[model samples]
Target: MFQNSSFFQNFSTLGKEDTPKSQWIVEDTIANWWRPNFDPPRTLGKEDTPKSQWIVEDTIANWWRPNFDPPRYPYIPAHVTKPKEQTKLFLVQLPDKAYFAVPKNFKLVAAPLFELFDNSNGYGPLIASLPQNLSRFNFLYNPP
Candidate 1:
């Protein structure tokens, strides 16, 4: 159906002759985006030092800063960061309310939205047995 189409007529040499018998070859010299060896440096730590900072320093030790002085922003922050305590308070309050309001006969049905574990264990059944409104609250309060 593609009569006189440029795609069919164009016979540009896309591949190189790697072997005499090999017809299919890749001609593009550009590097592919796929990075199997690329491991981004871990940014999470007590000081929040980016992994790249260590990698760059180790790789290019001789490269001096513009004025032969240390950079203004250190590879890691100076402060010792700690996790916030408010998260525990938010988690505990939900179950307490659900315990008093839910009836004994009412069964909690675990939905996919509430299920976090891949093993099909843990909070799946407990969450499934909860009321529909209660199940939805988990989604609503989840951080963006």
Candidate 2:
């Protein structure tokens, strides 16, 4: 299921007899995305640190790297850099009038149009929220 191209730089030489297995290491794909949480006696008590290839030594939330026994999934996004209070959080939902009185003239808004769907590739597009819309708020949409 994993992409080996991200795991090895010299992928062609890996199966050869002369190439040492240790050199098979390449830049981690996960590292390209989120920075991991690592802190020291040095700065701010929280810092995003690079995870070691071998998780047996460090406490990094890794899924495929460690080669650990009893597998572990990386904590689904721990915001090491951004805390909840420091974040500009907002809540968007259906209009209050919709719950109180369902309008016969109400239109249905699809969540997929807003790019709200589970992208795990495990299943088809999910999170298709059928929110009741008054069709009052028009949006500029560039459909995919």
Candidate 3:
């Protein structure tokens, strides 16, 4: 079971009200985004392959799967693994084509800022290197 928050967050918004379906669900949507060195349909070579059948199988074997020598991300006890109750954001679309959502109490007045990385391999890598700028947020939370 592949479990990663950032990995699934992208596709999570697809059927939501605020998401632009036309852009995401274009005719032959998979082909629109698929290309060599971008979204290749298969692994490069069987001769070059090692550890597992697919490249991701290696990742799961090393990181996600439990009971290895190094023990990467061991399964948390059920008591600790219980899901926390979280406020859900309701997507509200404006007539002017702006998207906004508010979770429980706080008001989100500003429009979302989307930062596109030219070198992003995927959301996993992109989110890992996020918040490129802290200066912009200094006004919001300043140390005394």
lDDT of each: 0.24, 0.24, 0.26
The regions of model 3 sitting more than 4 angstroms off are 1-81, 96-108, 115-144
**lDDT-superior candidate, 1 or 3:** 3
Residues 41-90, candidate 1: write the lDDT tens digits: 33465466322111111111111122223331212233524211110001
Q: Given candidate 1, what's the lDDT at residue 21?
A: 28
**lDDT per residue, candidate 2, 22-52, as tens digits?**
3422233222321232111223545653233
Candidate 3's TM-score: 0.16
Q: Provide C-alpha RMSD values for all models, in order.
A: 28.4, 22.0, 19.6
Each prediction's TM-score against the native? 0.12, 0.13, 0.16
In model 1, which runs have C-alpha deviations exceeding 4 angstroms? 1-98, 114-144
Model 3: per-residue lDDT, tens digit, 31-108? Answer: 232222122234466555221111111111111212222322323334533322211122221132322222233232
Worst 10 residues of 3 by lDDT: 53-62
Clashing residue pairs for model 1: 108-128, 108-129, 108-130, 109-128, 109-129, 110-128
Runs in model 2 lying further than 4 Å from the true structure = 1-23, 27-72, 75-144
The weakest ten consecutive residues by lDDT in model 2 span 10-19
